[model samples]
Target: MQMSWHRRMLAAATVAAALSISALWVAPAQPSARNGTYFYMVMYRGGRASGPVESEMTLTCFPEGGNHPDPGGACMALREVGGDFGRLKIAHADCTMEYSPVTIKVLGKWRDQRIKFIRIYPNRCLVAAMSDWVLNFP
Candidate 1:
């Protein structure tokens, strides 16, 4: 009877893990994901480890709107770099050499092009250093 209970628990755990993995697949399948100038961003803590999501927000450049605190500012920042995350430049002056570790996943369309980028930073400050307007939520 104990063996049966253990097996049942294992099966439940496996199913939950599978669901977590599926959400992190980084695929652009939904209609919202393919929309114009859309960006779905998620921040994760724990240094490149995909354990749990810390925060997330959606930014739409075409119309400049989402849950982002400053949609207009973020859109302007993106325009400065032509909607290229790789070209995102540092706007801040200073940051520590902390090893707290933070990971960010961004996916969606920049105008007509499909965009996908995932990066792990030494700390949250670095992420903001890359781009405060586009990366900061609060």
Candidate 2:
């Protein structure tokens, strides 16, 4: 069957719009089990001579053999590493200790922070802090 050019263009446009909408609706992929467990640390820089002082907090998602270790669980470790300023070691069940750069941003409240890291297993991730002082797993 032969169709008019206008009709064809309209159909194409509709399909394109539908596809765009679907893409927006689709949920993001879940983080892999290997990348589940994570660590974080918060550091407060003191005076120039004093350098930086740090307070530690550990956050984990998995509860004793529940899939993979939670990213929140890793927070404490990360915080410690941060306190040391990238000199701390991170040991995982995978039995591998590696160092990678990380960025932590406070999203306000008790649990609205964002954490970003690269070349460290899972690549990119987002963590939200909760009122209970526990960070919400990504």
Number of the top-ranking candidate, with TM-score as the measure: 1
Candidate 2 segments whose C-alpha is farther than 4 A from its true place: 29-34, 37-138
**Backbone clashes in model 2:** 18
Cα TM-score of candidate 2: 0.27
Span of ten consecutive residues with least summed lDDT in model 2: 118-127
Give candidate 1 regions above 4 Å deviation. Answer: 1-35
Error of 1 at 121 (Å): 0.8
lDDT of each: 0.80, 0.35
Worst lDDT 10-window in candidate 1? 26-35
Give all TM-scores, in the order shown: 0.69, 0.27
Instruction: Give the TM-score comparing model 1 with the true structure, all chains together.
Output: 0.69
lDDT of 1 by residue, 1-138 (tens): 356888999999999999988877965444344457888898998766478888898888767787888889888989888788878878764788878878888887887888888888787778877875588845
| Overall local distance difference test of candidate 1 | 0.80
At residue 110, give the lDDT of candidate 1. Answer: 82
